[model samples]
Target: MKRIGVFICWCGSNIAGTVDIDKVAAAAGTMNGVVYVDQNKYTCSEIGQAMIKDAIKEYKLDRVVIAACSPRMHENTFRKTVESAGLNPYYLEIANIREQCSWVHKDKEAGTAKAISLIRTAVAKAAMNEALFAVEMPITRRALVIGGGIAGIQAALDIADTGFEVDLVEREPSLGGRMAQLDKTFPTLDCSACILTPKMVDVAQHEKIRLFTYAEVEKVEGYLGNFTVTIRHRARSVDLQKCTGCGECLAKCPAKVASEFEEGLVQRRAIYTPFPQAVPNKPAIDRAHCRFFTTGKCKVCQKVCPADAIDYEMEDRLLTNGYGAIVVATGFDTHKLNDYGEYAYGKHPDVLTSLEFERLLNASGPTGGKILRPSDGKAPKTVAFIQCVGSRDKAKGNSYCAKICCMYTAKHAILLSEKVPGSKAFVFYIDVRTAGKDYEEFYTRAYEECGASYIKGNVSKVFPEGEKLLVRGVDVLSGALVELLVDMVVLAVSVDARADAKELAKKLAVTVNEHKFFTEAHPKLRPVDTQTAGIFLAGVCQGPKDIPETVAQASAAAVKVAAIFSKQSLLSNPTVAEVEQKLCSGDMSCMAVCPYGAISEQVVEERRGREMVTRKIARVNVALCQGCGACTVACRPGAINLKGFTNQQILAEVDAICL
Candidate 1:
């Protein structure tokens, strides 16, 4: 019989107060195949680990069962302990007594019984365990960064600095994301573009970075250390090689469409660049609005182009490349105000979203930095800023703070007072959340120094009054209803996940929470990492975050990519599914159920009597299999089974537990 050692941890009062540790250890020593049993106050501690290593050497134990906390917490720790003791890591099995038995049960008798059963099951599994080794795969040494926003730019720049090739893909024509459209950032009030534009230029000039503007990541295949990515290069109808960033085409084009860069505050020519300091500075023809595409007659851009760069017949091209890692920094979108019709957003021309107000405050915007009312081109003397429009409201389907709204609203009030002399700025907020560096002081300055009125209340409604808009709300602090006539009303709308976030999450096989924000591997420990290895998350795509946090996350993701590239090869998980060729029925049932596409058909030569015959059987690719064990249950003839969690091993455990 195989020799097994059982280690039971009291876990202080966590397990000992509820379950009898001595009785459980004594019971385990009598179990079949178990040669040694030891109890410890903390088995994961250094002293307990030394005891385990000494016992293994003394008892000549080949398999070990640790009845302790949940495997998620210390499975890897114990696995390493076994490996250090000259034993295979896979030979170790963990019984969750702390969480499953001790913590869950109130009665000591019931807890002791469950703990013994758990330990027995673990010992049974340990007895049937076999040694397995990891498969080494080659690394690609290249990285792909999605989104051209500040996060992606920073990640790309950092990875490129490590002497590895990086492909920076953007859906927009420019490199700057939402930050480019903002007037100024919070607290410090530093110009957004002043800091962001230089990085955009750095990404453009970086020798190791390839800028893929007006592109999207179409498909991603392969596993960690090696991935094949297909990027769809959308037709810009303008050749980057031949075109010089001249204003000839823009000046001559007849088509005028709403500008996305300006948040639809002004009109832009069909043949236009996003902004003056665009990375490439080249213009892309908007095929939807361009007269050449809409009607065969108008080719004003083509005719006016001095370089003859416009290509109306240009087709979208697909470029496939390889990468070692991918960093997703898709960013976020402002919550649409459809549900907040009570604010009269679309109905009233003077009522604006925070984003719209940001564009208005920008010096390059339609009114040339003047905060003018949309209904009438006049500057607003009184501006009302409303906070938490679609945020922290269960009725609107969002119950989380937008995080940046409170600070940005404070920023708006401060800027309003500075830009317009004697302008009255009134802010209505449920709560002022200024919990960042120097943020509270900035909010205090807005009220104390900038002469802005801070009202603790929720805006009830905003309707048209004679010449100005009337904002009605109750001052919660004063316990009085207040109505003020304001020239312009700005709603601090909620920040939400991008519209296509869920679709992209499905494509990448990454998990997104109920808020549609991409879920990280671990919220605190693995903030930059996604559940999928070799893929990382950055910026607001993971959750609502400020620019500082976004940049830090981007750099962290870049460091992860650099670390992967630093390694020549990666070790594949040994717990992946394995196929027994002798038991194969030539059925593809295992292939049908595999979520990661790890199983495939392979031809094998089999001896039938005295002759050899070729037959098809399911083959498992260990690199792709995440050791989920779904293929194990799907096989009818039992040809496929996970290496660490084998059929015999699991059955042995079931038998022991039932007995």
Candidate 2:
């Protein structure tokens, strides 16, 4: 029989003010294997800890129960004290009396009775405890970064700079990603390529970074500290070592396709680079649009290239790599604003998205930085910027603020005024969300200093008339109806989930919120982490964020990876389940009821190498198991038993406490 000691805490008016702590301790003292019972003013206090440890030595107790606060508060502290007194740490149990009993109940007798029941339960639980230890496993010190956008690039660079190798996988042909498509970063007005292309070149040239453009993540398996990732390297149809990027093949190629890098604003040849300053300085042949793929007659790019880099026969290959950690910086896609009929998104030529405006104002864009209306190629005198088109609307099922719209929209208004001098720019927002440092001041400067008109209202409708958009809205604060005949309408749409974020989360067995963003372990403490260990989340894929927030999270994820690598190997919790195959009747009763999928089938073989048939046997993956003991109760054959909290230990403690 296991010797049990029960200690109840009054918690200093927390429990005793409501329940009778003395009677509770008396009831616990009468319980069957319990050799001692006492009430402490505060069980979690230093004096109480000393008394408990001294009593353990005095009574030669094997198990201890504390009826006090929640286990989340002081379970570890008491367990450490027990270990110091030569007792197994797992033999300790905490009964939540203060919150779950005394504080919630109005009747003192009922609360005390409830506290007694809880203490009895803890003694019953602690009597069955067994010693357990953590198992250690080695970890590989490498990382895999999904997506080649700013977030992914920043994470890869941070991890690589910390002396760890990084495999950067980008689905696009170029490394710049969505940042390469932008004209300038908001509020700063700095050239996007000037700041971003340098990082691209650095990634391409870094010894620790293995850049794989035009690649996609096919599979990811294993847990933290040891992950096996399979990446599909799509055939670029051009050899990097041989291609000179001299534009000779691009000039001669006859086939043309829409330039996805420009968001279909311009056209490019079948064999061409994504942009002028593409990293690796190579051109890829678009097999879908190439004439040779359709008719097998034209090899214009191959024949024209002096270096002969084009290879039509190149096929997709799967490459497997091992890494210790993973950063999911999949980024976000813009919400399609065509759903709302209030804005003529696709129907009117003068109404455009913020991305389209970025191209129109870019120096390398189609019009060479000319702010011309798409309808007639004429610069407009008045432009209206609409905010919250697809965000914060219950009809669209997106209720969260996008977090970056205000700052960027203010920047757009200022830049548009600069692009077309003497032009008037009006911004309509549901509310100006400038929550960042110096962000509210920036918004104030846009209105007070730059003379940009800012109004608090939602544009109810937009219609086209003679190459102009008629925007109508009423300012609720000013109590005035306003209508503007603007030459162009730029909708500041909200940032949404990446097109493949849901599919990727499903593949990784990670949870995503209703907004289609990846869910973090905790909103505050573990912001850059996913619930799955070793798999960290960074940037807008987790939520709507600005560039600064994305970079910060990327660095945070790198810190987590570095910490994981600092350990020689990870330790597994020993409080896991164990199965006895001999007692199992092969009826598969425990296998069907177990939620953790710990049970499986095993074949028993004879000594003469004869098959003994397959039987449903239970096995536990100890590292993933939490040792809840539900399987032990469900097993009809009594084959399943938890290691640390065994059935024998629990019943012994229960009998002692109930005596």
Candidate 3:
């Protein structure tokens, strides 16, 4: 019998508050194979690990079970701890007493009983644990950054600066994301374009960084240190090499559509760039709205171009590349106001979401940097800014606070006051949160130095009376009803994960939160890393954050990618699925359900009677298999099994659990 050791963690009241650690440890000592039992205040800490190592050396424990947090949290930590004592890293099992046992059950007796059962099951499994070795794979050295947003731009720049080749992919025509649409950034009130455009230029000019604008990451395959990414480059009707970015094609084109860069405020030529400061400064023909594409008639752009750069036959091209690591900095989407009836976001021309308002403030916006009402194009004396439009509202909006709304609202108020002389800005909110440095001071400046009123309440109604908007709400502090007539209304819209965040997460094989934001491996310890190795997250794609925080997270993700590229080789997880050829009946059902194309059929030679014969069997590519155990479940003959979680070991755990 294998000599086993049991360690129970008090978890510093996290577990001990509801579970009796000493009683559990004593019961563990009486279990089969457990030769030594011990308890620790915090089993993952240095002293606690020292206690575990000392006991293992003293008792000569070959197998160990730890009653503590989830294995997802500290399995690797304890694996290292045991390996330091000359034991197989896989010769350990963790019974989740914190999240599963103590944290979920309040009754001490019931929790203690459940903890014992869990530990017993873990001990039984640990007895059957086997030594496993990792497969070393060479690193590709190049990194890939998804999205062309500020987060993606920053990450690409940082990674490229580290001397690693980086591919920055963006679906949009421009490099500047939402930041490029802004007039001025908050707190400091510096010009948004001034700060972001330089970075965009740097990314375009960097020799190590390859920019892919108007392109998307079509597919991501393989594991960490070796990912094959397929990118779809949307055709730019105007040839990039020949076009000199002159206005000839745009001026002669007889088709126009609502401009995305201007927040749909004005029409742009069919053959046009999103913005003047676009990184590539090249035009893409909007195929859907282009006159020549729709009617197959107009070739004015082709006839008028000095460089003859128009290519009506252009088609989307797909390019594939290998990357060592992938950084998902896809950014976010502004929450739609479909449910926000009270805000009247779409009903009135003067009312707009925060992003639309941001564009209105820009020098290139529809009003040309003028604080004019969208309905009449007349500058008005009063404007109302509503906060938390679709944020922190359980009934209709997102439950999480859109972290940037408050500061940006303040910024809007400041911009309004300066742009329109004597303009009064009224901001209504449920609560004010200014958590960043000098954020509170900046908020104070909006109300004190600028002519703005801060009301602590939710706006219940907005009525259009004549050319003005009447905003109605309650002042919670004074218990008084407040009504003000304003020229325009702006909703501080909530920030949400991209509509396709889940789809993207599926492609990367990463997990996402209930809100559809990408999930981090550990919120505190591994903020940038996803559960899937070599895949990292940055900016609002992970959660709501302001510019500074987004940039910071982007840099952090770059450092992580740089660290991976610095490695000579990466080791694949050893606990991958292995097929027992004897048990495999040549059924290939396992291949159909694999998200990663890791399983394939192979022909093996076997001696039947006096002659050799060849037969088919399912084989697993260890490097591509993520150890998800789907193959094991699908294997009808019970042939496919994951290391460290084989059928026999799982049965032992089940039997112990039943007892």
| Candidate number achieving the greatest lDDT relative to the actual structure | 1
lDDT leaderboard ranking: 1, 3, 2
Residue 635's lDDT within candidate 1 is 86
How much lDDT does each candidate structure score? 0.91, 0.83, 0.91
Off by over 4 Å in 3: 1-131, 577-621, 624-642, 645-659
The CA-based lDDT of model 2 is what?
A: 0.83
Candidate 3 lDDT by residue in tens digits, 502-540: 999988888789899999988999999987788999899
Q: Residue-wise lDDT of candidate 1 within 317-419, one digit each (tens)?
A: 9999998999999999999888887799988889999999998898888888888899988889999999998899989747999899999999999999988
Q: Which regions of candidate 1 deviate over 4 angstroms?
A: 1-123, 578-621, 628-641, 654-659
Could you tally the backbone clashes for each prediction? Answer: 0, 10, 0
Taking all chains together, each candidate's TM-score versus the true structure is: 0.82, 0.83, 0.78
Clashing pairs in 1: none
Where does the lowest 10-residue lDDT sum fall in candidate 2? Answer: 605-614
Q: Residue 593's C-alpha lDDT in candidate 3?
A: 73
RMSD (Å) per prediction = 5.6, 5.0, 7.3
- Best of the two (1, 3) by TM-score: 1
